[model samples]
Target: MNYIQGQTALDEEEKEGLLISTITTRAELDEFEQLNIESAIEWTLHKKLKKEQLLSESFVKKLHQKMYGNIWKWAGKFRKSEKNIGVNYYLISTTLKILLEDCLFWIDNKVYEPEVIAIRLKHRLVSIHCFPNGNGRHSRLMADLNRIDPLIAFAQS
Candidate 1:
């Protein structure tokens, strides 16, 4: 959040953390509910996603909404709005889909490592910069869904 003016003596202010925190980057936290979920899983890198619970599209959408409804709250919850930047809109929804598909595919095939999945998910989530706010927190929560983390409890609704 540090800013330096670009003139006599300013212009090299690198944003400390992507979001509002020092350790967490923008890709880290996407949802408030994620912290809770992560905590339940623990520090294990092999944390597994809920395959049964996520089978239903409706269920996933609901979980998504519950996890990140706040982002929509900044504008509209579901439907798109003309007033928003195209990139933001795309990032929010597209990234969500990416998250679901990637995790499912990676886990189902059992070819990918959990750490790899989590790392990729976390990095991309932040890169997308979805949601005007809270994108960072949500990304972290989503990425660590199966892991045992204190933040999981906090991220869950």
Candidate 2:
């Protein structure tokens, strides 16, 4: 795969997950993923989601699935192998749960301003790197969703 500067190259195993076999370059892959992501964003905008639903592990996984399901077989699933960054592969579920709980607590107690909460949640989600790819884009979309609903800045992650 031809990765643009700053774009992370997918490992061979991860690349095999791609649904579109014709895409052999980063730009082509990016364009396809971007189109899929746009559809997912539209889906989120049209749906009626409760706050509790938004903050759950299922929602996070579902959002990822929506964002990349069209392009990757492993889109919504948490990675099963070790990577260069993020919590251990075995600890992804537990770590993400803890992060969500902490965000909930912060919101309940007004522990931080909404913007701070959003940024922290976004940063942490990216750090967690739950999926094999698109963590950064996922984190940003989550933060953007939070901007739409002010109750808590931690939105669909």
Candidate 3:
């Protein structure tokens, strides 16, 4: 496992392609991660989202994959092991499905202000910690992308 600044730890299960020697320092890792995230942001900016896309498990996975696939081998995949945070690994899919449904209802019913919904979604997604790494960033990106319109409508544009 690569130590970030000899303090914080990156996941030990990072892809084999990531060598401690290749990125000896946290600063280097930060730079690489930033570059990857920038590219993902660019992609989101250019691509038009559809309503169906927001409700998709595949879309969430793909977005995470796009954001971190280059940095981690397990980018698009869920964690197999339990972490100190998040629901059980097995519950990820089910919990996410429920969240999506709730989000749909929120949009359909105008249940909350758009900003509140976005913040709520972001907070809940971070809590889920769906990915081995980059969950917070991934969730934040998802929330930002979701702000394009009225909840579900955001995905439409």
Candidate 4:
């Protein structure tokens, strides 16, 4: 696998989760994942999800599932083992709960502007690294969904 600089190399155990066994190189894997992610983005655009729904734990997992379910068996599930980054595997659920709650509180109280809230949520979500793979992409999409209304409004103006 010809990995580019800074790309996280999946361990053998993690690689075993790939649904496409024929994928042999980083480029092939990335292309497949990108296609899956594009479909997930389109799905989000069509769904009329409420703000609360977007911020919930279930939604997070569901979105991740949507993003990578086609190519990876562990798409929506939390990692079972510790990785180089992110909180311990045992802390994932509790830490994610707190982050979600905090995001809701920030929104309800107008603790920050929409863009700031999105950035904070994105940063925290990536830091948490909830899923086995696609954490960065998932977090970006989550942030975009979280602030979708404002984004649309800005585009229209």
Candidate 5:
């Protein structure tokens, strides 16, 4: 099966699978790379930080760097300058917010099934392309956690 992880605007087939994948897919995460998975975690932490939820930014940065430890030393840190992807231009944190606010809407909402929220967050995070890399996997983690985590999903949002 060919699956696109972080695609915000889905083709017809993707939308059908959206709710299904949010539940079953997160259970078996072997298809995703470790880096992608870790970045997803970092993105969630980033989202929380953006909300002023009181998590340490430095720790989240360490986690992000640990995700891509060998390849990029500056993994967790936000880029100092602006970035461009195709025609779209964005600052690092703005991209992060897209994942947090827009993509993670299910998590943002006051009440919803974790299963439901996961799909929404997953879909939206995939859509945001927040980081230069690992966005799909980041979407996955954000979705997965928000789906299961009532506290973070509710308190932070």
Candidate 6:
């Protein structure tokens, strides 16, 4: 579980279920994961999304699965044990439900500008750290899928 200088370390729970054992170095794992995530992004880019669809728990789980399924067997599944980050393992579902409801409310009421909404959603999701790995990337992709233009401008700023 030793992390490369700047890379995040995979905990026992995170790496225990990996499908690809040949990946020994952090760079190799990162490269494979990035490729998998890029493919998921391309797949998501073509889909037409509805507000309800965007707010569903299923959508989030499926998105995570799509982003990391090639690299890990536990992709899309919530962590079963505590990690160095994230909510307690048991709270992930309820916490995510609350976050999604809040997001739905934000969208429904237009409580924030689109850029703000996307940024907040991305930040909250990453804070939740629902998955064993790739929460940051998954959340970023989720934000991008919501409103790419706004997120793009928001990021550049």
User: RMSD per prediction, one decimal?
Assistant: 11.2, 3.2, 3.4, 3.1, 11.4, 4.1
Residue 13 error, candidate 3, Å = 2.7
| Candidate 1 vs candidate 3, TM-score winner | 3
The TM-scores, one per candidate, come to 0.44, 0.90, 0.85, 0.91, 0.46, 0.88
Q: Which candidate leads in lDDT? A: 4
lDDT of 5: 0.46
RMSD of 1: 11.2
- List, residue by residue over 40-82, the lDDT tens digit for candidate 3: 9998877766655765789899998888777777788887767
Q: Model 3, stretches more than 4 Å misplaced?
A: 1-11, 15-21, 150-157
Worst 10 residues of 1 by lDDT: 7-16
Prediction 2 global C-alpha lDDT: 0.83
Clashes of 3: 0
Put down candidate 4 lDDT per residue, 1-157, tens digits, no spaces.
Answer: 6556655556778788889989988789889999999999999878886567878889999999999998988889998887777899889999999998987787777777777888999999989888777898999999888776553234334
lDDT tens per residue, model 6, 84-145: 77789899999999998887777667677677878998999888888877888899988877
Pairs of residues at least 3 apart in sequence or in different chains that clash in candidate 3: none
Candidate 6, superposed: residue stretches over 4 Å from native: 4-8, 149-157
Tell me how candidate 1 scores on lDDT.
0.44
What lDDT score belongs to each candidate, Candidate 1 first?
0.44, 0.83, 0.75, 0.83, 0.46, 0.80
Candidate 6 lowest-lDDT run of ten: 148-157
**Which pairs of residues have clashing backbones in candidate 5?**
6-126, 40-138
lDDT at 47, model 4: 85
For candidate 2, lDDT tens digit of each residue in 4-76? Answer: 5654456788888989989987789889999999999999988767656777899899999999999999999
